[model samples]
Target: MPVYHSGFHSYVETEALNGALPKEQNSPQHPNLGLFAEQVNNSAFTAPRSENFKAWQYRIRPSVLHCSEPELITQHLIRDIHHKDSVLTPPTQMRWNAREITEEKVDVISSLVTMVYNSVAAVHLYAANSSMDKSYFYSADGDWLYVLEEGALRFKTEMGIIEASVGEIVVIPRGIRYQIELLEDVARGYICESQQAFYLPERGPIGANGLAEERHFLAPDASFENKEGDFSLYAKFQGQLWKMKIPYSPLDVVAWHGNLYPYKYNLKLFSPVNAVLKDHSDPSIFTVLSAPSLSKGTANIDFVIFPPRWVVAEGTFRPPYYHRNIMSEFMGLIQGQYDAKEEGFLKGCSSLHNPMSAHGPDMDVYTKASNEELKPVRYKDTLAFMFESKEPWQVTNFALNSVLRQKDYLTCWQSLETSFKEVVVEK
Candidate 1:
């Protein structure tokens, strides 16, 4: 799927209601700052403050984040809210909280982001299906990557529904409402909470030559709607949760026009290439979606993978095509096995490859692919992905505190050796 870097609207949350001192109220004591503050005394807020009335002006407002997240928004928000008057969790009971944060360090990582949260984060994912419920599709405020490791999901969102397989992935951004129906007797996947929005992998000198392509991304065909029903919606606002009852299907926007909207693409759509000469190419060739960073033309994180592709670089040890990156990369495997980590890495497990930290397929896979025949070979059954980031992702409690995580992943490469004799060495 084509991915692009995205960020918060900075103003979407605060600008609309801030009662800043407006210029109209500016009388030497105060000056109106923005639109919301401009209407200060207009009743939407309290009374407008005049520029000249600084010292005599106002009483301090309480903390906005102080109340349960849901209450904070509902008290002032006026929009098409999905109210959950049915079997929905309460507003204050959404997911775990980020009480105290701790960061982890690794070497040779991709610019990709791979984060695991234990008792305090919400686990989520994204998927593209052919036949499922439209109301099952939803969005969120942060990045939610779903790892399909166990069964299949007859998933649905605004984009439509399909049967998602075990190796597939599904992403749901904050604020969108979606639901899931199991096509199998059981449905399970890894829920990756990307506090950072996933974006398009950055284009360096290679430019658009690699990574996810925009045209590959598919959006909902038409705004599907439930025209005349009073249904309940489970809205997870801020961290607080609440239910909103509306007269129509929440997904009925007809057509949306914004980079902020959600879309799903299968990694199976990826088109990869190997070299005809010696030396392997970059892992970025496997990029799916990327979220850009605050830096000028840099990525916050790039979702790359080590999916099955040709190992055609002639004369060079072909696996991974080895090297370091300015971007940190985190890699994970699904199904079969990854050549780079044939011995240690396993399904449902992960590894961190930091910026400048050099990594490649294990010495074994590197040597075998290098020495093998040069004829075109199609690698199947292997599925690996990377989460590259411009910044080092702070390892959350989920990654560190969970029994579901592997602490030994840091030492995964301890047994790699340099004894492959068949593959030709690069000059």
Candidate 2:
């Protein structure tokens, strides 16, 4: 199969060095996936990259750096992937009042997820009547950001409605209370949530090439429209629950501009990094936005993508083959069915494969790909994404117990009735 495994070393390798050297761990730009960087930069918020609290935004921008050399930034990230892993003093606890509402309550998925990965972890939730319930949560210890991956959503703030869809982003200041509404059948695509605050990926080599160029990340232009009314705001106070009543909508932004904004970068706008010559490159080559968790250390999380594009393989398995990992991978389909698995995982459907768990296409996919005639296939219909986290995931009780969830997803991987010989090649 044409598996685009990351060429970079895993975080585990680099973190070992953080404690030994400790000198080079001062910035977020370390190339390797740094895990302890957040611990070192915990005091960043005191500097307040922005004064007071104001909304920042970015929109459907694509990288324009393809023609230029990428090895510069790529090498930096790859080298940094081998930093030291020192445990932080301790992370401040951030919680929200997320309770099971229905007989089967949706376990509010809180408790900061990723540490900011080289890969972008984005979720486009397709929920019905599911209000991401009024909850207050924040990384008091670090700045956090959220971007709408796709579809429409209403950010339910204490003030009022902050609406967005594909190519839109919302930067909820740290220690903020926010909820969401799926105005559309499914609200989708969440990005840049983790210990490492999401920032615009540096365009070191791109310089003027325009990859994720600033102009494309359109900030919110609406004026601060004010509203007054009774509203209830819930806060995650010291890992406990607390509630208070407020009298207005906080999203009444008339106009604003700042780097600390929420914006979306359309995947299509991505100046896709493709191979000039034939050979598979790591999917990091497709990274739209990368947040480095490791400051003085290595990366905590990586948000990368396998966007829709042409598939070129003469005799290789064009789609992803089956595999598993130690990291938790939460995957979602963006539009149509993926080239690998034409069935299941509908556009709005999501699948969670925890650490060390086996995943990848089911048995049927293997059978089909092995014998199917080779054709220059273009993965034109869909976008298959992943939210890979360094921290092991705690399958929410809801996820663990939802009927909508397929407990027997294992059936997808049932062993094939027959087997084929492995293709061995001589060096």
Candidate 3:
């Protein structure tokens, strides 16, 4: 069956087969096919906002059947910024080359490296060599946004199956049971888990035609697994991983219908709105998804992109201007190069500039853009993105001490000569 494209707030009803869903009512006194009705609420029942998301499902077995005594596991995924061995360093631009798999047979959950955490969200770097078998993981902490930098990952969730590759992102709502199986030998990517719901930013004057169209966002159709085996349901709650043993597979949703289901979007489909006359537009114009914080105008986490686009502005600085931002920026390149940095920023590589951190174009890019002809130039073969947050990220010890980190990252702008002019522009 073809996948449906419904707006985030609109109702989307789907079933594995016809008549599986109850007619005229969401929760029926007797569900069809001897199924049990379950509601997955992503927001409070009486939330005033119309964007409040929730879904209902008629499954083969109630989720209560999968419940058991949970035992604490030794997976310490939370990065303590104030810890004695924390990698919290002075504010400076940091970059790392694509990391290598140091160990063999690393699974997705185990490969997670919690880079930073704050009240709103947490940033994580993940690289896995093997697929998780008979193991499913979900977080009671927050919803997850997965940006695949390398490798293909197929996620089998209670709702359905969704596959994500490089240059694509898959969002798994909080508390949704899902397990990832890698299609490639090794998978590397970035993940952001936040307490807030990621939504499309208001188009305002730009209207709703440009940027990421909600119709292009693909949600999986009704699909399920009826496997009977020794399975485990792993939950990450309160910054710790807990495992609950179950006899049968917990992914037995025979039929489901909901707007809160997981979905994936391709970055290439983003219609970028760029400058036509003067200076470069703010990166917020390229934001695919944004999680708004309590503070108005500031985002908890804005998933913005630097997609391949044309540079056509005349008599203006073509590259990003040097400035300090109030938001913390965590950038990762999915493929090709970032315009601000001519080198070192490669696919699967990442860079970070904390809140109010001084950062801009590299010396080489700055010099080239200053002298290069100002014409309509199309920047091709590049897809770089950032998880910009309102709060600063507490760097993890592993990221601080990783061999992939560039030791000479601070020297990128050393060649920028001081061009201070003694005579100011006279009126």
> Which has the greatest TM-score?
3
Q: Model 1, stretches more than 4 Å misplaced? A: 1-140, 143-150, 158-173, 190-213, 223-260, 321-326, 355-376, 410-412, 416-427
Show where candidate 3 strays beyond 4 Å: 1-6, 76-89, 424-427
Models sorted by lDDT, best on top: 3, 1, 2
Expressed as tens digits, the lDDT of each residue in 1-427 for candidate 2 is 1111111111111111223222343323432322222111222456554222332211111111122221111111100112212322111111111111243333223322222222223222322335554332332323334444444766543222356666444545445334666666433444434534554455455455533444444332232224455544444322233345554543332222223333334555555555433445444455455445545322345555566676666666655655566555656556667655666666545666656666566667777877888776676766666656665444333333445565555565567566568989999
Cα shift from native, residue 198, model 1 (Å): 5.2
**Deviation (Å) of 223 in candidate 2:** 1.9
By lDDT, the best candidate is 3
Clashes of 3: 0
TM-score ranking of the models: 3, 2, 1
**Over the stretch 111-160, how does candidate 1's per-residue lDDT look in tens digits?**
01223222213332222222232222233335566667655764444323
**25: Cα error in model 3, Å:** 3.1
Model 2 is weakest, by summed lDDT over 10 consecutive residues, at 1-10
**CA-lDDT, candidates in order:** 0.45, 0.42, 0.84
